[model samples]
Structures are given as structure tokens and as C-alpha cells.
Target chain A: MSPGPARGPRALTRLRSEGSSPEAIDQLLREQRVPLVEGPICTFLWRGDADGVAVDHRMPEIPIPLPLRRLKGTDLWYASVELPRGARIQYRILVRRGESTESMNDPLNPRVVGEPIGSQSVLEADGYLTPDWAYPDPTVVSGELVDLRLPSRALRRDAQVTLYIPSRMRRDRRMPLLVVHDGGDFLQYSSMATVLDNLMYRRLMADCVVAFTHPGDRLREYGASAAHSRFLTGELVPHIEGSLRLRGDPRGRVLMGASFGGVAALSAAVRAPGFYGALLLESPSLRFTEATPSGTFGDVFEPVVRFVNSVRAHPKKVTDRIFLTYGAFEPLAVPDRAMAEVLERMCDELRVMEALDGHNWINWRDRLLDGLGWLFPGEARLIYPG
Target chain B: MRQVTLLGPLDGVDLAAEIAAFGVDGPVALVTAGWEEGERNDAEVDRRLGGGSRNLNLYGRRLDILESDPGYADAERLLRTQIDELRELYLLRLRHALAGLEVIRRRFAEAQRRPGSELDAAIDAVRMLDETHTSSIAAAYEHFYAQNPPHERPAITRHREEVAAIVAGCAAIAIAGGHVGVLNDCLHLGHLAALIEERPLLAWSSGCVAVSERIVVIDDDDPAGRPDEIYDIGIGVARGMVALPAATSRLHAHDPDRLAVLARRCAPSVCVLLDPGDRLELRSGRLADLTSVGVVAEDGQVLRGAQAA
Candidate 1:
């Protein structure tokens, strides 16, 4: 027998009863299955009003087999949406759930300190904010296959590395270098070059060199394998230094990537202290499981933990600064929080921010400005130009 | 150098002796038992000496010393002090040294601004001295003592030389290099990959167990009587389907069964190293005892012959 819906507080009638409407009951059940935001989400507006806020709920375009529903009950709402694994969306509710007529301010708004209930407040989606240092119109300088060979061992097969340098450059001195992993996706989706150009035009960030590294064939090679670390420490760094004519100091070096790349960049910094002072991580895949061992990409997580622990134990050995951002909706948020806690405990200066969205390049790009301001504040002065 | 002699049980005596010998330049200040025991011994020795000597005596005058005596003290005491004091002077130096050594022994196991060439030179000096100075291995105790002098240095350096030689030989074989990678508690296939990548590696028993391609997967840890799986051996060279020396049988009871299965499964003939001084020479993929090393056994039946099958 099919389970029944509640008639009252305690009584229930079976959905398959002779006179029952199974479709309606099924719909109701489906509606109830929609998940709500578990924790609080905060939004900060650089420019916006507190009134006339309306949040539009847009369902994912993909077809989902399971019956999904959206239910606004009490002070929260639940929605069954099929989102891509790493996609992020920014939204605001049209009105408060409980207060039908009230124009109350969102309690989760970071900008609003205090607002009485029943007061209508406006919510808006902030445009994605690229770092001022991002290339405004990044022309692909060249995309070529590069081999990463280990210096100490010849038996090891070399990994195929792809390097992409943004064509936009300044005439003055050498530009700061930013090395990013997952070059293919970064070149396509991140809009990193455009962001760099805008930042440069505005004088927010100094002219910087960016090297986008393509992940190798093996998933482990890019993410969890020790060879990945070696590739970065032994091969990639030297390659960048020699080929790009980039400054080799910590201040001039930066590493950025999303998901596994996020963890990989951080791992590289840990393995080679002072190699990269600035790290931009987005929705980092920091979780480790035996079934899906992190070793596939490279031994990123444990080495990071060891390096951070040692740094925490001996602060004198660590001087690299970090800027980390994560989305609340990301599946790896819990692990990301754990990583953040570790970094917080070790670093003398660390900036961490949680977005009011899931793991998406959209949210990552949106948060880049803030992360960059904190990481390269002097660059900000260059962008704003006093 | 300052010298220190730790008086306690045998568990950590070797380490203590090594440290004392390397750390101090002077004769080690001996402390037997606890502080109370040492004080009692001091009183006994003083009484025996008719209260005329300030020296503390141990082992019936085989060793006698004063911490401040100029005769037996070394330079280590002058260079460094007690462990606690040394740690305070350096940033986690003591803990790092201990942790580093532990990591080198396969036990449980960044960034900075640009410093000038002078700073690099200073650091290079220390690194050079650490790498060189084979004497450091033997003089560890003397070094400690000299930094934190407790007693006078010995008149001869032969003892230091002997200790150094032993340490050099052992360290050369045991420690691969100065790096050690600490992984998570659980075993992961990625660790094997990392090992191949040449990151100094450490792994628990389960970690090692999973590395081989073929393994007798025993279910001893399970409460239920579960079957064992003979899986493919791991990629590590140290592990394979082969017979272990007879001496290992005392340590592992399942060795016979494991060996039998391996012999049947492996190609190119299987060789077993038996204890009691024996070698088994293989001919045309068959096993035979060579040099009358030890008796052979198959299927719980012992075969006694100079050329046993």
C-alpha cells in the first residue's frame, strides 16, 4: 500500500484509496521533497537600495527524472532544481516568506545592520566583478603543448603541459605573473583575460603575466598525484620563469584555479614555500575518499595539510599570504571549511569569503575583485589611480 | 661543549647516550634514576668520599663528575643550552629536528619574502655544515654537551669517532634522503603513485599491504570467519609471490600457506629463503635444497635430501 498524506495533525488517508486522487497526492509529495537552504546566506551590495526587492527563481534547464517541487513554508522556501555540478547562481526572494504584507529587511543582508519587520527590502544580483588585474581583452598569445619532465628521474614519463599567456602587455617593466591550471576551461569560461584588461585599464592591478596550464590526460596528474606537485615545483615554475621572463619573487607570483585546480595551486605553494605568495581558490575540491582517492590528481590535500601544520608549528618558515573564497552551495563546502580553518590557523594573514551561491565560475568571477583587492591591494591603487 | 648523561631505563638509553656524546664537549653530567635518586646517590657518594669532593659519582667510580668542572665539559654547552631553552631561542627548532628525524625514520610524519644573498649565504653555511661534518653523526652528543656544558670533555676523541662511524653506516642504509612525506592515516592507491614520484614516503601497515599487485588478503581483523583473497601483487619491488626466509616463519604463522600459494601461482619458479642456513637452487622450474641449508616441506610433508624436490 502506498503511504498516505496527513488529513490532520495525526490522522492520515491512503493515497490509493478508492476516491483518492493519486496524481495530486503525488504532486504534493513531490513538492514536499524540494530542498531548502540549510544555513543562512549573506549578501553585500556595493551599490543598491533596501526597498523594492524581488527574487526570481529560475529552474535549471536540464531535465531531472525525479519529481521536484518548490515550497515556501514558514520563513524559508525549498526548491527541487537540477543544477550542474559546479554551477552557481545568485538570486533573491520576491518577498519575505512569512510576512505577506510586510516589507522587512533581509536578516542575512551583510549591509543592513537593523531593519524592522514588515518593511519591504530590495535585493539585486551583483554583476560579476572581475579582478582589476584581469586582462580586459586577453588575446591568446600562444597555445602549445609543453612537456613536464622531472629533473631527477628519467624513467618517469613526461606530462603534456599546455601554456597560455595573455597577449595584452605593458611597455614599462616586466608584468606580474599569474599561473592558472585547467587552461582549456579557464581560457573559455573564466574570462580571465578580459578581467585582467579591465583591471589594467582602470589601473586596479599592475600589468601581470598569466600562464594558463592545461590539465594532463590523467586526472590524478593534475589534481592529486605527487608528480603534479613536482610538475609545478620542478617543471612549471622554471618553465614560466625562463620562457615568460617573469619576476621570480613571491610578490610577483600568483596562482589561481577552480575545483581541483584550486587545491592544486594551494598544494604547489605549500610544497615550494614562497614560490607563490598569492593564491585564488574557487570551490576547491578538498575532500579525500579511498574510492575516489585524491592521489589521482596528485597528493594535494595531505601535503597541504602537512605543510600548513608545519607552518603553524613553525611560523617562521611560512611567509606566503593567501586569499580563499568558496560558495555555500558547493558540495565540498564542508571540506573547504576544514581547509580554511587549517590555513587560518597557519597563515599570518589570510582572507576567506563564502559566497551566497554554489560552486560556479559565475560566483567565482564575481568574488575575484574582492579576493584580488585583498591579495594585491597595491594593484587596486593602480586601477583606481588615486 | 656541554655533556649530559641520562640515567634511566634502557628504552631510550641509546638515544640519550648518542645525544650526550654529540651535544657536549665535556664529560657528561650523569643523573641516575630521578632527581631524587640522583640526590640520594650524590649524598651517598659524598659520604663515601668523606664530604671532601664536590664531584658526583656513579657505577662505583667508573664515572665521576661535576657539572661545572672544567676538566670534562665540552663546547656544546657554551653554544646551546637545555632543550627547553634551545627551543625558545629558535622557532620550533627542537620540535622540527625531532619531527624531521622521525619523518626520516618513516615514522608518522613555506613561503617567505625574498631575502638578500647574505641571508641565503648564512643559511647555506648551516646546510653545508649539516651535510658535511661526518663528525656530526658521532659528535651529536658532544655537540649537545658543548652547547649546554654540564661536565668536562674527555681527554681522548676515540669514543666520538667510534660513535660517528656506527651512525654513518646505519644512516646511509636506513634513510634514503632528507625528505619524508606524511600521508593520511588510511591507505590510498595515490600513495603508491606518490612513492613512484619520488617524494620521500611513509605508509602504515595497511598502506604497505595494498601496494602489492598480488597479496594474500587475510580477513583476520574480521570477527566472522571470512575467506582470504589472493590478489595480484603490488607495484613495489619489495613485495611479490615469493618464499620468505625461515626466520620469518617465527614472526608469521601463515608464511607456509602463503608460500605454497605463491609457488603455485607465480611463473619463472618460486624461491624460498629458509632459516637455519639453507639455499634452494632452482633447475628447470623445480625447487631443490642447495648447500644442505634446511629441510624442505610441501603440503605439510618434510622432504630430506641434499637435492630435494
Candidate 2:
């Protein structure tokens, strides 16, 4: 069954507020291109084999099962959403037709960010620019990534971790260690290795051994589990240090993660106080009371909130420095702000960067330099010492 | 953990007597970058440090370096221009938001309602604005440093070497108050943070503010009546404390609303007033075992350490 007519006069709809001419919009739509806009509403059009399409976003307030209308006299399906002026959102096209039961990335969109489960097409509304440093260049020297495995009795399984060592690393030198949760996702999707290389080469951040920890069962483990904390502080740190030469001082260590991984990082730091110097938390799931709007994760609330609350109540600091980054567009912004307030007195230095982007790898990738620079300026300058 | 002693305005405090207590018989490292070219009369400071004060003329040195090296000068100018542009935009936004906040405040007053979430959201928005401005400034600074690193530049390298030698030879470093911005610039340009390395440091007024984690500029008497502007992120040596030098004179301390704003803006970092003759000892970027004075409480009241009476 072939689709209808190849083209028609009603094939293009003039989005008046989008600021682009109808001819341009028609040209773009005909070419199966995503239209860039500088306004609130972004009309995402997908023309293909699909009975219906819906956008799944990180915002918890927006109700799910939202359907897109099919353009009359054409196979084009479209949905207009009012996003923040300059926020990046990841959305997948949910095709309701044929054997394709799964939500698929918009093939027409060139900008895509990878994830553990799959890839999602990125939409930067209102002229959002991808940070210059986030994009890797061939001219820049890249870091080396080595895969390692550690037996975790706490989780009753082995965990795979990717270690990124800077190309400028010397054997005699004692480098800072950054252990990141959701390791595999970050390495593949966030372009973290490239970021580290650029930062170190530019002398923005010090050379460090980044341990990317891959999870076994992320949903079960990353929700502030004490066992997972033990697995990280007790098992992982010792094992990594014993095998590799890392600076023994707690001041030389950093714990980092995003989303559920953010919760895991903080939980680990709180469990073993003074173990790490700094913490990099990106859009942590602090609130367990409510479910996300997109219904990405099932409504399971208690453990994560309890752990976050416990950290807030802790008398002294778990670490010296804390770097917090959150998206202005996400539902977690308010909770993250509250968490920051709770963490203010708890740490010596607290630096925050709230970008105009949704909860995704791209935003997290952009924040690496800022977080690292804030936490280790002394070490950063030493990279290009006199 | 370097030993740090913070003082009020040196104009009122006995500079000579202050240094003697530290048992500093060797030449004291005098950092007068804050004073700019006005750091002329050091006879009194010399007398206090047993006439062996190694005046590290950081401001003068920076000027000399800028005059000699075109590349450094151009980079510095470009950075300053970018920062100034950012600052202007920040202040403009801040003023507009503050005005909006006033309107919101009036609405709450008329309704006889306590502004709760609305006020918090407004404040957060303002803070976010500040954060964006700070990030831009930092990015500009970082870009400049990457291109023309002070370590790589011969002019800066020479100044740092001299500063390092002076710092090493000195028993204690005394950072004097002047234009806080100038002081901070020279301190950063000279790479004083790395050079000082665990030295017992004494600072007053702007010096104390410059050493802290962040520099907040506030002046109630100014024509614009600007809200406290977080000017610069400091060297992080003096942590967990926002030092407000000449606080009593410049701040509208009697007004609860003003005091509340000051106290709330830089929370977690204890906002302390450095009045004349006030003395504080800081260790490991925090208050030492000694009783800390001039802590501003959330109740809009300035608290003094209570003796067990």
C-alpha cells in the first residue's frame, strides 16, 4: 500500500510565529528537515508510515498519551509544543502503524543524542547552541579508554567500568580520580572522553583518571542503595587504587553521575564521608513522591527521597566541593534547587550551573569543564604550570 | 591548611602591633594590589613589620607588564571589555528584576499575604541570572588564559617568580585593602595563590573579600541603590565566608529587609561584617577554633559571640 500524492498546495502549513517564510518552510518540509525557530511553539513534523505520533519529554507536569494530528491530504504527522525559550528536548516519534510498535528517533532530525536504551533526536528551540567544547575535533589529542571489571559482592555481580586516561599522563605523576556512575551511557552518548581531552589540552581541567561505572540493574541499584554505596566506596575505590596508581588523598577524588546515577553518587559520598573531595550531580532524582510526566519510569518513590533527605540532614559535609547542574526545562529543576539549598551549608564550596536544556547527555557533557574547573582550579592551572 | 587572619580597616587597627603578635621578625610580604598606585606610604607598615616589609607592588607590576607586553595587554583589554559588557547587562537585568520584585512586594502587601513561593521563585530567577553572567565571565577568562596563559607569558612569569621569592622569604603576607577589583586582578595575574602556598596570611577589607570564595560588591549609598552584585569568584583560599569589609558604613544594617537580602543572597557562606578593629582567624578556608564575630543571622540581626556568662 503506497502513500497518497507525492505533493500538493496544502502540503505546507505556514506557522506565522515561527518567523520563517512559507516558501522556506515548504522547502524545508519537502526535504524532510526540522525547522529551527526562535519562539515558544515548535511544530515537529514527521512524514512516513505512522498512524499516530507523540512526543515524550522529561517534564513531569505534562500528561502522556498526547497525540499528534495528521495533516489533511498528506501523510505528514505533526505536534506543536510550547517549550522554554532556549531549551533542548529529546523526543522520539511513536509510530502507531504497521509492525513498528516502538518509539523511533526522528530520522529527519540530524541532531541525535545516544542513551543506554536507544537514541533520541534532539530539538534545540529558540536558537540554542551546542557548546563549542562539547563537539570533538580531530586536531585535539584524545584520551585513551580501557575497559575493566570488578566483582561486587554487594550487588552479587560484576560491574564493567571504562577508565579514561589522558594522553598527557605520566607514570610518576599522581592524578586526581573521578568515578562517574552511568559510565557506559556517558562514554557513548555524552561525548565525555572528547570533553576531557579538550579540557585537559586547553588546561581548563587537570588530567585525571575517569572511571565510568556501568550498572547491572540501574533502576534497582541507583536508587540510593546502601549496597551500591558500599560497592562504590569499599569495593570499587580500593580495587581501582590497588590496581592503578591514584593519589591516595581523599582531596584527589571526585564522585559524579547524572539522573539516577546522580542519586547513586551522592548516596555513596554520604555513606563514606571524607572519601572524595568533590561531587558532580547532574539533574539528580531527589524527589521520589511523584512520577515523571512521560511515564518513563514506574512510580517508585521512597528510597531515593529518603536518601536525599538524609543527606540534607547530615551534620557535616560529605565532601569539600559540590557541583550541581540542572535543566531549566525539566521538572527536577525545583527539587534540584531545594537540594542545592540543603547542600549549601553541607559543603565548603557549592557551584551551580542551570542550563536551558532538558535532562539529557548533551547538557551533562557541556557542564564537565565548568564543574571540573570549579572543583579543581589549582590543579587546572598546574596543567600549564610555569 | 594555611593560617589566615582577617582584620577590619587597617586605618583604625594598629598595623605594627598586629604583625608583632605573629612573631614575624623577617620581612613581611606586603600585598598592596588593592591600593593600586595609592600604596605609597608604607612607613607605618614597615615600622610595624620591623622595617623589613617586602612590598610586593602587584598593581604597579601588572601595569608595567601591560605597558611592556602588547599581547598580554591586548588579551587583558579584550577580557576586561567582555567582562564589562557582561556586567552592564547583568546590572541592567538585576535592576529590572528588582523593580519587578518591588511591584510583587506591593501586591503582597496590598493583599495582606506573605510572599512565599512567589518571592522564592523571583529570587531564584535573579540568582540564575547572576549564575549565567558569572559563567560567561568565567568562560571569557578561561578562553584568555588558554590562549595567553600567564605561566607561558614571560612578563607574567617574571612577576610570579619575583612574587614567589618574596613570599618564600617573608614570615607573613599582609594583603591590604584598596580597589577590590584591582587587587583581585593583580593577585590572579601574579599567580599569588600558588606562590603563597601555606603562608600565614593577614588581610584587611577588600583583601579579605578578594581571598574569599566569591566577591560581592554592594553600596547602599550609591545613586542607583544597586542590590549586592556578586562581582567575582575568588581564589577559594578563604572559604565558607563572605567578608563584607566596611559593612557598617556601606550597608543599611538597621533595615531588616536589606539585611535579610544580604544574608539570604550568599547563604551557607556566613556573611560577616568586618568593622574597624575586628579580628578573625581563619583556618582551612573556615573559621578557626577562635570565636567568630560579626555573623549575620537570618533574623536580620548581626550576632556577636556570647561569652559564657
Q: Model 1, range B208-303, lDDT digits (tens) per residue?
A: 222223222332222111122222233332332233222233224554433332233332323333342333332221232334333324332223
lDDT, candidate 1, A131-190, per-residue tens:
344444443232233444334231155544445443444221345567777765655555
Task: For candidate 2, write residues B1-309 as lDDT tens digits.
Answer: 677888877655677676766665667889877655556567776676567788888878888788778777867766765675587568768877766766776788799998778877776777688778778878988998899877888888888898888788888888887767778888898787776566778888788888887888766544223467888877767888888877777776566655665676677777877777677887766877334457777656787766200
The local lDDT score (0 to 100) that residue A287 gets in candidate 1 is 63
* Model 1 chain A weakest 10-residue run by lDDT: A377-386
DockQ, 0 to 1 scale, candidate 2: 0.02
lDDT of each: 0.39, 0.73
lDDT (C-alpha) at residue A131 in model 1: 35
- In model 2, residue pairs whose N, Cα or C atoms come closer than 3 Å (at least 3 residues apart or on different chains), thus clashing, are A60-A293, B16-B48, B34-B178
Q: After superposition, how far is residue A295 of candidate 2 from its true place, in Å?
A: 16
lDDT of 2 by residue, A1-386 (tens): 11112232232444333434545556666664473342565666776657667666664455464466666555566666566666777877777766555677876688787776778888887767777778787888898999888788988998888989888753324677899999888878888888888877665666788899998888779999999999988888888887776775686789999999998988888889899878999998877333444223344546787666566666468887789999876878988988887777767767788887778888888777778765543222111000
Top candidate on lDDT is 2
